[model samples]
Target chain A: MKFHWFHLMSYPDLPDDFREKNRSVWVDVDPNLYDPEVGHHAYNEYLDELEYAGQMGFDGICVNEHHQNAYGLMPSPNLMAATLARRTTEPKIVVMGNSVALYNPPTRIAEEFAMLDCLSGGRLVAGFPVGTPMDTIFSYGEPPATLREKYREGVELILRAWQEPEPFAFNGKYTQLRYVNPWPRPLQKPHPPVWIPGGGASVETWRWCGEHNFLYAYLSYFGYEAAVKSMDAYWETMAEMNIDQNPYRAGFLQFVGVADTDAEAEKLYAEPALYFYNRCLHWYPGFTSAAGYMSVESMRKGIKSQVAQAGSALSSIGQVTSTETSWKEIVDKSYVICGSPDTVVERLEDLATRLNVGHLMLLLQFGNMGKELTMQNTHRFATEVMPKLRDKFGDHVDHWWPSSGLANEKTAQPAPINSELGGNSQPTPD
Target chain B: MEELNLPSGRSAKVFTFGDNTAVGDNIKGDNARQDNDNYNDSDNCNDNNLPLVFFHSAGGVDENDPFLNQLAASFKIYAPVAPGFSDLEELDDLVSVSDVALHYDDILEALNIAEFHLAGHSFGGMFAAEYAAHYPKKVKTLSLIAPVGLWNDDYPVLDIFATPPLELGQYLFGDPDSELAQAFSSLASDISGNEEEIVESIIQTVQGLVTAGKYMMPIPDRGLNRRLYRVIAPTLLIWGERDQIVSANYAKDFAKLLRDSKELIVKGGGHMITLEFTDKLVEAITKHAK
Candidate 1:
């Protein structure tokens, strides 16, 4: 199994009363709460961690986009990918990815992704996310009814721009271009492998991914147990579409932490995990789904399911917005897998075996986790846990990984310790 | 009530009542007793009342609504279901509010009616105002009950799209404990454990909201302020005194913009004025439409 190190890059210094006092941590988050001075350090530190993960022999390093939210500091993942292209020799720099519908002329994304692929020597995993309601409908103000159509059109435009081989005039409902061509075509022939990160609710998205032979990454805050139904649904759709049951076609993100022993790992990870699940995810219920965001068919299918009914009940009563799951509850739900290397491997292997996912995107750096603890977590997991699971899915060809020859090169080296930075050296508080 | 297939693959459900057999014979006789209670029984009446076009609220089309039935007693009523409100896939064909307004014009043309009295409630009122402003000559008389076309920054309309089902009643009615409010609120309730019934209910509610969102999501104003002055027909603006959705304060703004308009505020009514005070609405609509 291939492991990708992912980071949400959340703002770590939320006030103590943020959950009680703030309306939400996204969309309309108070701008005064963001400290650029702190952000300067956070950005550098987060980038250093990604480079460190690349050096630690992780197969891929990923960054994603979110707007007007303290939960994720990267509103422009492309900028981070560009910087990573120059700063690190990471085999796969996945910008998972630009919200295509938000761009007026989506060929701009094709141009930028091409430039990044060229800069990275053809090592790019292009992710096209439909984006969350907060990002697309609320922040960007794209009409909910037409968001999916616009996204589909934008994807078509971007793909054609990258591969059409000749400059062409293109006319689309949402976008129109007199000359539809991007200079400096992608280094990879016919563009980079496309991956779609989704919440797994929309049946159309599942069918789209299956029909196009794209990897469907089930990006969920809810853990593997909660993700079973969606993953099963995707596989069922794939079966009906007559697509191969290659496990590499699926990717799953899970929050993880590791240490020398179970007790020590719990001590090191509990606070940050709680902060992530409780404070960072404190979004308003009303902002969850915009009207007409989901198609009428999808809404009908979703509302009939028992899970959706429960979710609606919770959302209607504001339980999802106000309730903060305790650290114990988070662990019980497996929202985070924290323990010794052996314990972590056992749980992850169980998850991988159950879900049959070939790509595991591990979120190592989460809410308010200090640099030292994050590095410790990353180092231990890469050194101990990853080796045990690397050969589990060895027989399956990973068509989803970067085709750039550099992916197989060995780059395992310990990250340099920065003792001068007090926060980077601080020991995890028990 | 009859279903008429329209152009552009659209369809409308219309309810008609007046007798067309005596159209020219008793035209003047009907004009004389316009104020008499007996004139309401159009079957035995000598009145030559113009066809009344009733538009349903944003919630969805209800051809059998009590207020509409009451109005039907006086004149032939045509309540056409708006696109998107019904579970029709043709909703994708409707791109804008103007498209919806023009479609209604087509419906009128298809029905072979040149001019008529038009009345709409809430979201329907917004569509009616848009229709009147676009084809002023076709609308002989206009009645709007707690419409949502005009928006005020000081007294902004409530975001009903975002409101929870249980709490939506507070914004829609003066006394949510009342029988009518309970009935209106019941439409949103998930009373059945049966998945199919629950799914159907959600689909019904969501489709209506999606239809409404085509014209009023993000913000309710669709530049009606600029078009209201173009409507040359005499207008009547009615408001529920306790309306929480679009505040009753907007009644004055509508009265000011309309060419020859009058305002009436029903004391105990809410945003669902037609549902709560059907008698008062029927009375006001009858007086103004005449």
Candidate 2:
């Protein structure tokens, strides 16, 4: 299995009465609570943690985008990726990634991702995500009704821009381009590996990902057991579409903490883990699920699933939204797997085997977890735990990983499209 | 109430009154037929009365609403449930406010009504204004209750979509303990065995809001300010005095923009002035319609 270190870069200094006083930690969180002094230290320290993970021999370093949220400070993951590209020699600089729909022309994403690929020597895994409601609908003011269409259109434009050789005139429903020519084509042939990160709320996203042969990375705060149904649904979709069940086509995020012993790990992680769940995720439900964020069909499916979950005994997903969950409850539910190397390895093995996930994105540094503790946790996991699980998925060839060492080879130019005729020069399929 | 089955594969629930006018009988597969039309042969139910068409707010056209029932007694009332506002399949053709306005125009053409009085509440108020602006000759009088098309950065409209279901009463009613508020609260409750009903109701409500968001989300302004002057119909603006959603101050703004208009502020009311002060709304709409 491929392991990657991910950080949310959350602002940990919420006031003592934050839950009582603040309406949310996102969208309209009190700006006064954010101190730039703390930010200066936080950014450097977070970057240091990522670089440390690279030095400790992880497969990749991941960063994501979120806007106007105290839970995540990286509004521009590209900038973070650019910094990582220059700072570290990590095998993969995974930007999982820019919210494609928010950009006006969206060709800007093509240019930026290309730049990152060139800068990182083609080790970039470009992720296009239909961002959370908080990021897209509320923060960016994109109408939820048209968000998916805009996102798909943006992705198409970016892909075509990356591959099409000649400067072409393009007109789309949401975008118009007279000349679509982006300089500095990516170092990777045919472009970098594209992955889509989603919250598993929309079945259409799963189907689209399966049809396109793109990795559908399910990113959720709800742990493995809670996410089984969604993952199974995705694999089922892949099977239906006749896509290979390559484990690399799936990615999952989990909160993890490691220490000398199970008791010590629990004691060390309880405070930060509780703070992460209680304070960082104190988002208003209304803002979280904005109207029209999901399509009508998805909404119906969601209601059905919610009703089913309500009936089940393992209804721990519902508790993630509640403010009253204690540390023990959070740990027991496996929202955060905190234990010694042996205990963590056993639990992770079980989780990985059951879920059949190849890409494991570990959120090592969470809310209020200082750089010292975060590095210590990173070191323990990298040294004692990751080695035991590396050979588990050795039989499968990961088609999703970046062709890193081959970046220096020259890429072939794409065949030109006849723009005047308004059709591809290539033969049409029957 | 009559159900009009349009060729567009969408049906409209319209409460109508007048002579026994059954225009389209060939239309098949409808719950309400020509004989099912709830036409009361009252004294004021004449073509001369000039059919007053009522468009419901974002919540939906509650036919049993006492306010609408009261209005039906005096004038020939025809309130069409806005497409996608109920459990019915949303009309894919009606995408924007302009599309909905044209759809209503088509309804008028189907009914063979040359001119009529138009009134709407909240989101519907915005629609009424847009319709009047688009086809000024079709409407003789326009009434808006807490309309939402115009936006002001200083006094923003409250986000009804983001408000928790239980706290919605606080935003909609001036007195939380009022009968209407209590009724709304009761509807919000999740009672056992009523899960289907509750889920359906929630879906309908969300569907309506989603339809509204096509025009109102991220800001309700759709250049209605520039077009308000085009509405030659005599306009009447009704507002809740204590409205926490759209501030009462916007009434003057609407009055200023409308060429021929006046304002009525219902005392002891909130965003839902139609439900909270039905008598006052009835009085205002009746005075204006006449």
Going through the candidates in order, the fraction of native interface contacts each one reproduces equals 0.30, 0.39
Native-interface RMSD of candidate 1: 4.1
Residue lDDT tens for model 2, B38-153: 22434433333566888888888765867788777666678888887764345456667788888888777666666678899898899999999999977878999999999888
Q: What does candidate 1's lDDT look like per residue over A1-430, in tens digits?
A: 9999998899988888898888888888889999999999999999999989999998889999999999999989999998888777755898899899998899889999998888888779999998888888778777677789889999989989988868999888789899987987887877799999998778999899987788999998878999988888888888999898888999999999887666776788888888887789988766667667787766666655543556443232222444788877777888888888888899999888888899999999889999998998899999999999989888899888777633554433334457455536767799
lDDT of 1 by residue, B42-66 (tens): 6654334577888888777654577
TM-score of chain B of each: 0.86, 0.86
Q: DockQ, per-model, please?
A: 0.30, 0.34
Give the deviation of candidate 1 from the true structure as CA RMSD. 6.5
| Model 1: residue A383 alpha-carbon error in angstroms | 0.6
Q: Give the Å error, residue B39, model 2.
A: 25
Off by over 4 Å in 2: A305-322, A405-430, B1-47, B86-96, B194-196
